[model samples]
Target: MNTPLRRLATITLVMFVALMGSATWVQFFQAESLNTDGRNVRTLYREHGNARGPIVAGGEAIATSVPVDDPFGYQRTYSQGDLYSAVTGFYSIANSRSQLELAENDQLTGRSDQLFFTRIRDLLTGKRPEGAAVETTILPAAQQAARNGLGAQHGAVVALEPATGRILALVSTPGFDPNVLAVHSTSEAAAQYRALDQADGNPLRPNTHQERYAPGSTFKLVTAAAALESGDYQADTPVPSPDQLTLPQTSATIGNFGGGSCGGEQVSLADALRTSCNTAFASLGMTLGEDVLREQSERFGFLDPDLAVPMPVVESVFPSDLDQAVLAQSAIGQRDVQASPLQMAMVASAIANGGRLMTPYLVETVRAADLTIVSQTDPEPYSDAVSSATASALTQMMVGVVDSGTGKAARIAGVQVAGKTGTAQTVEGQPPHAWFTAFAPADAPRVAVAVIVENGGNLGNEATGGAVAAPIARAVIEAVLAS
Candidate 1:
């Protein structure tokens, strides 16, 4: 061949090799990601052809796949759609999956490595492929109580078994019905989703673990734990209780709720906490300094970016490198200190569980279609948030709050409830958010709960965590204990 002809032949061969390489990369190396992509229409159709597993709670299926007369062999359906929306989320043909539907998609679709043996058996026996059942830790009674307690309000409630870190109840309202989005019609599902997205409060957002809020006096639990752990304070230790505490180097000052005195010029730490004294905690926070407070906050699970109760939990935040003024505000869960209801519930759980903070988890077990267990979550410790002695002291102080202070609404008829109430300020002129966190039967605690009512619920500016949020917490505790 001539030199030009030889060069032309080499170029053609190079082009052919490039095409082959691209095909191999897409067909092999990138196959998994491409197949799992939410936008992949073919993958969605293929998945719908199989019988997806049921998402069970309290031994009943909350989410299940049923045979349909459409091209897609199965259709997803949710029981009590609005109540479980935050947990089950929706599996839609028009949009991506969410919550458990997204987090456990592999197991739910029978594609997880844990299900390999089951898949092989089904293939060999010529049986229809089926996904693994996902059993959640949700308690139906507690969940229903939380829903009824919240009652058409905008907020969230999280209840955890302190000893196990099993989420008993997780609720966010006003919630959207997953059924509306689960319809087989792509156009109908898309339209319904758009409406829910644009609705007030964005019903699609799960507030229990996905959203954050100022914790208000409820965060004083962290500050109090810091003080007790520092070896400088005790339940009976007298701390300054001035009506107004001026921040360092700034003219601005922090005052007690309703501008009232916290008993006297100096009050016991327990008394200050029982009264929810802002000035006292602000003074103590400045005294303890930012480092101690931040570390303590993190120990209680703030600033952890990767916490997942199966579904991803948006990390609670405690801002760093703050000056004295911001530190004072943050010390009170104001400023930039933000937390989810789940994080606050963990704080109460740690205190209830003798200061051992267990890692929170949602899914209890995953079982193959034939009823063989594929995976189970073991209870694990997340941190030692405080010493047992410190937790006891805090528990006693919290009980006092429920007995005589601002948290009286959380009182149970025959049970000793330990709790803290918070009224966190938000945008200027708007009502502050109401918050309450507590555990019941303090001596042998069964349930730890956190409740937040946004914009003071129906009371607006008139809402205090005690008046608005505490009762909700009380109802949840009652249900958990009764069950």
Candidate 2:
């Protein structure tokens, strides 16, 4: 070949190599991002073209895809839409997806690597591809009871199985029906989305795990656990419990609920916890200091952000770099201390499970179109939050709260219930938020639950955690036990 002919051949070969590299990058490396992009019309069509999987709980479908005569062949429909809105968020053509619909999209759309073999088999057999079903850990009875108990309240309830870390029920009130967003008409879905976005409480945001609130006295559980873990206190350990405590380095003072003594000047740690004594915990908080308290909080799954029960959970925050006065206030779950209901439920679950803090999970299993199990979530330990001895002591103390103290409303007939109550003070004008956390049949706890009623529910400033939140937690516990 002539020199010029050889040079032309080399240039052609280089161009051919570049073309192959670009094709590989687009088809392999950029594939996932491209397919997931909301602007990709072809990807949207492909996802909605097939039969998407159902989200099942208690043998009933909470979310399913039904055949529709449209460009997108299926329409996502939710059963008891509002009741389970926190769990099965809407899959919309115009607005895209949220919650479980987005978290488990890979499995539901048959795009998960776990379903790769299934997809190949279907393709080879000339079968129409279908998504994998997600079986949730939700208990229908508990879910219903939670929704009913939180009637007209702006709040959230979360229940967990102590042993398995399975989320039994997660309910967030002021919920929106997902069906409106799942409509075939894009314009209608967009209109519905706009209305829901503007609605009170922002129904689209799930309160159960997505938003955080002042934990109030419910956080006393963590403070108590820190105290016990330090080997410095026991249930009967006597601590200062004055009617009012002058905070160090600040003019503000912390006082008991009724501006009265916490069962006399000095009380047992158990008594202080039972009475939800603000002064006692504030004193203890100052004594333990910020580092110890923050460490204890982290042990129960606070601070660390990457938590997901399949769906992403906004991290519950325990503030850092606190002064003595702020630390005292934080010890009683105020002064920037915030937590989601799910986080508090984990706190109770850890105590009930003998201090083993399990990593909470929602999806129990995933099954292929042929009903073959593709994956099953195993219970995993997130941390050893406290020693078994400490847990035992805390359990007894919590039981006293329900038996004779502020958490009396959570009592169940013939059942030993362990619980704590909280009335977190908000801004000066707004009513305090009510909160309760409990695990029933304390000796052999099956359910650990947290309930929060924002702005005191219907009772206004007069509402207490025992009055508004404890009853809701009790209802959820009873439903779970009965089921």
Candidate 3:
């Protein structure tokens, strides 16, 4: 080869080697991500070809892959449609798969690691087998009750079995119907899915566990825990002031919900929680200091990165370097402290279950088409996040809040209800959102609930959680308890 010819040949070889190396890296290393990407047509082809399993609740098919006389053979159909859209989510050839549908994709389709042994057993018996089904912990009655209670209201209600952490109902208003995107053809499904994905309402958020909200006074549960754990406050421990104390690091003054001073120039811990007194609790927060309060909050799993929920779950925030003023504000559940309904439910569950917060679960078990149990979850205790004594004391305090204080509307007839009510200030001028959390028959404590009603505009700023959100929470608890 001459000078020019040799140079061209060497250059060509180098370029060819580099191209091959790049192809190898992506085709092998990045293949899983690329193929699983919602836009991967090949993955859609595979999903449609297989007889994907059904997602059932209350003995009814909420989600299934229906066969269509098309080239790919089938499409995912949602029977409950919009009612359970947030839970089952949408598996569209047009849009991406998400929520429980995507998280449990392997299990729902009966190709999970646990299904291998069952498959072998079927082969040994010389019988062809269908994929498995996913039975969620949801109770239809409670789900309907929540839907009815929140009718025409733009908020969410979540109820869980406190002992087992099995979510009975997860409801978010203004949801979308999944049927519109369950197209048999890949291209059509993809197109339909993108429309919803691009829409402004953000219908995909299963608000109970996914979206973060100002926890409001429901967060007082955590503050109470911090108080007890610090050894500073007990059921009868007294707070020292009735006046709103000016925040140390800022110009803000923390006062009671209605700006009423805590009665009698001071109040006992029980009385403070019962009245939902902002001043008294602000003093408690300052006394506990950042270290004690933040430590207790973290122990409650507020900052967990890998939350146990299937879809995204937002972690509760508690600033580490909290100033005296910041501590006071956080104690009243404001500014940068955000949490989901699931988190509040967990807090209530922790108190109900003697300070042990079990990880919340939606799907209780996965079974074969023949009704064989493939997998299940025990009522496993996550952590000894609080002392048993502390839980008992907190339970009593919450019960007091409901019986005669702010959460009175949450009382269920014949049930010993324990609850906390909140009317959290959202903005300087806007009406605060109403929040209520409760668990009933306090002794056995079966169900726990957390509910939020946005704006409370019609009801006006005077809408405490008792008058607004508590009734809804009560209805859900009654429905579940009746069962």
Candidate 4:
């Protein structure tokens, strides 16, 4: 062959090999990402045409796809639309998926590896494919109670079964209706989501698991845990209880809430905790230093980069590399310390579960269209935040809070309740956030919960965790116990 012809043939071969390699990479390595892309209209249409499964909670179908006469073939519907919107999250063709809808999409779309047999059977029988049913661990009564308790407040609530890490009830106020996003019209659905997205409170976002807030005095639990774990302090250990504590290197003075003294010049750790004394905890936090506090906080699941209750949980933060004054403030859950209601619920759960933090979970079981269980979530221990002895001491201290302290509003008639209340100041002119966390039947806990009422629950600056959030928590605990 001529030299020019030989060179042309070699170049052509190289081009052919490059084309094949590119095709293989796209077909294999990038296949999953491409298929799951929210903007992929083809995939969206395919999922919409098929019969997606129902998401069942407490024997009720919270989310279901019903038969339709339109090109989509099915329309998604949420029975308790706004009530369960935080957990059941809307499925929309306009925006991407979220919550359970996004987390278990593969199973719901009949494309999960566990559903391989179901897919094969459908293919062989020439029957249209159907997705699996996702059964959640939510308790219907508890969920409803949480919703009713929050009422018109702008905040979030989360309840958990300590032993199993099963989420009992998750709620976020100023909630949006998922049905609006599930409308068959793509243009309409997009418009609805956009309206919610641009709204003032960001109602489309679930504050229970997604948004973070200053934990306030409720985070005193973490400081107490750290002190106890350091082997240097006990519940009755005497700590400073001055009306005001002078922060190091600064003229700033940290005083007890409302400037009330936490008793004598020196107070027992137990009394300080019960009183939610800002000065006492602030002194303790500075003494323990930033390292120990952060360590204990992490043990209770703070600063975790990735956490999922099957759905993603935004990390609770404990700021690192702080000076003495900032650390003192952070000790009381301030100065850049932030947490989600779910994270606070985990903290309470750890204490209730004998210091063993169980990994939080939502979906309990995934069943095929034939009602055969495909997968199940087993109880898993996430971490050990403290010793059994420390937990016992802390429980007693918390019980004291409910009996006579700021947490009195959380007390139940027949049940022994242990809890903490927090009123965290936000900006200079804005109202503080109210917080409450508790576990019931003190000695034998069945439920642990966290409640947050933003902007003082309509009490203006006077709103407090005891006056605003604790009573709501009590109602939820009562509902769970009754059920």
* Pairs that clash in candidate 4: none
State in Å the error of residue 325, model 3. 1.4
Per-residue lDDT of 155-231 in model 3, one digit per residue for the tens?
78888888888989888765678888776655776677677667654677767777777777777788889888877
Candidate 3 colliding pairs: 93-190, 94-189, 94-190
Task: List the candidate numbers ranked by lDDT, top first.
Answer: 1, 2, 4, 3
Model 4: runs farther than 4 Å from truth?
Answer: none
The total of clashing pairs for model 4 equals 0
**Scored by CA lDDT, what does every candidate get?**
0.95, 0.94, 0.81, 0.93
Best by lDDT: 1
- Give the CA lDDT, 0 to 100, for residue 217 in model 3: 79
Write down the worst ten-residue block by lDDT for model 4.
90-99
lDDT of 1 by residue, 104-213 (tens): 99999999999988989999999999999999999999999999999999999999999999999999998988988888899999999999999998889999999999
Question: Which ranking of candidates, highest TM-score first?
Answer: 1, 4, 2, 3
Residue-wise C-alpha lDDT for candidate 2, range 207-261, written one tens digit per residue: 9999999999999999999999999898999999888999887788998887877
Question: For residues 1-483, what per-residue lDDT tens digits would candidate 4 score against the true structure?
Answer: 699998999999999999999999999999999999989888988899999999999988999999999888898889988999889898987876788999999999999999999899999999999999999999989999999988988999999999999999999998988999888788998899889999878988899999999999999999999988889999999999899999999999999888889998999999999999999999999999999999998999999869998888888999998999999999999889999999999999999999999999999999999899999999999999889989998999999999999999999998999999999989889999999999998989999999999989878799999999999999999999999
Question: Worst lDDT window (10 residues) for model 2?
Answer: 37-46
**Which of candidates 3 and 4 reaches a greater lDDT?**
4
**Listing every candidate in turn, what is its Cα RMSD in Å to the true structure after a full C-alpha superposition?**
0.8, 2.5, 2.8, 1.2
